[model samples]
Target: MAVFRSRFARVLAVIGLAAAMLVGVFVGTASACSCLPGGEGAKYARATHVFTGVVVGRALLSGDPDTAHDDKYRYLVLNYRNHKGSAPALVGVETAVGGATCGIELALWSSYVVFAQGDASDGVVETTLCSGTRLASGGPPVTEEPPTTTTPRPTALGGSSPACPPIA
Candidate 1:
């Protein structure tokens, strides 16, 4: 009877260990890089900088594969296909390499459709594979989006001083 109890205790310990390992495996995969899963249009809407450019430079700042952005790659682009916000013709992108940190290995001198997030306060351009930034297979687009658009003010029925636009 004592031997039976001892055997049962060992079995329970083994089961618990197995369960813990299974949970760890599931959690690791789940917590790993998960991009904004959506189509091109959805990614475009979220991106602050969307343009095609040639990568002119790449410098590895850190050897760590787990780093968010350890490499600084510069791009030279003239055309802005879709620029939601203002950016220089030449932009510096900080990114990582390998899928471990959700970074894509961007080749030097290769053209890419750079979808980035520009920090206005600090003035930095950040790009990642998760941002849908990919290589431009052919080249930059032939035409660009229209430079500007003006929002016309709604006129009041009888107004000397212009009132703010109505909420409705």
Candidate 2:
């Protein structure tokens, strides 16, 4: 009877372990951001703004110090194609802090080929990881030259020589 009980305990332990692993897999999938099947051409076709630019500044809108879904990032436009209208010298793009919600965190001073969807006239553009935005290193060759000199932009930040547009 003791031997039978010990074997039963081991079997139960193995079953519990398997169940925990299965639950973990499901939980991981639940937290992951899923995207529809599409390539660059499809992403570009759906984008309202496509540009190569450097992230000059960023601001936390709300939520914890980590970030909210709509943190604003300012970019100095280098080469771009604005489907809505003429492209501006600088633009604001909003996304979450990271990829949990399919949002992308653009590093300050880093260049990216941003495939975004928003009206440039409003002074703010928005994008996500699903938008197909990627590092400039792997993007198309820049045909036009970037700005030779930088201009000071306004921001809500204090004591800054260069800044982004004030938070609205």
Candidate 3:
């Protein structure tokens, strides 16, 4: 009886440890792509084009010459103005399409400020998840607006910058 009790206790302890480890792996922890925290100036400098636009179209690009599919590249069509590069009313850009891939997620008709690089080989623009392509703030359109009194801004302590900078 004593030996049986001892063995049971050891097994219970091992099981408890395993359960805790498994919980640690799955509880409130998810893997995500690491992106650079780029300021507006830095992102603008790196990007070949920067503009506000709406994602109007998307399609999965074929990798194989024989119509095989690959998630590494997806094509996006955008309608934009405030011409930063050219005067194109519509343009296509390459992006990533899967969990393992790295590119901004775009929904149809969603507005965003896109930072991208132009691919000379295909004459297409390319953007990544980390390339500073971000959703436009809530407004009638994605266009810029003048500072409003309703806007919540951090008050300055003295004659310096805002006292409370926004958190990341």
Q: Is candidate 1 or candidate 3 better by lDDT?
A: 1
- The reply for model 3, stretches above 4 Å from the true place, is 2-31, 61-70, 73-75, 87-89, 98-101, 120-123, 136-168
Residue-by-residue lDDT tens digits, candidate 1, 13-55: 9999999999988775332467866666667777787777777
Worst 10 residues of 1 by lDDT: 140-149
Q: How high is the CA lDDT of each candidate model?
A: 0.66, 0.69, 0.65
Index of the highest-lDDT prediction = 2
- Backbone clashes in candidate 2 total 1
Highest TM-score: give the candidate number.
Answer: 2
- Cα error, residue 111 of model 2, in Å, equals 1.1
Model 1 regions lying over 4 Å from their true place:
1-31, 63-82, 120-123, 138-168
Candidates 2 and 3 compared: the better one by lDDT is 2
State the displacement of the C-alpha of residue 157, model 3, in Å, after optimal TM-score superposition: 23
TM-score to native of every candidate shown: 0.53, 0.56, 0.54
The per-candidate count of clashes, in order, stands at 0, 1, 1
Kindly provide the TM-score of model 3 when superposed on the true structure, using C-alpha atoms. Answer: 0.54
The sequence of per-residue lDDT tens digits that candidate 2 reaches over residues 1-168 is 999999999999999999999998877533457876667767776777777777777776665555335444444444454433344767877776568777787778788888888777877778887888888889663333344445666444644555445557
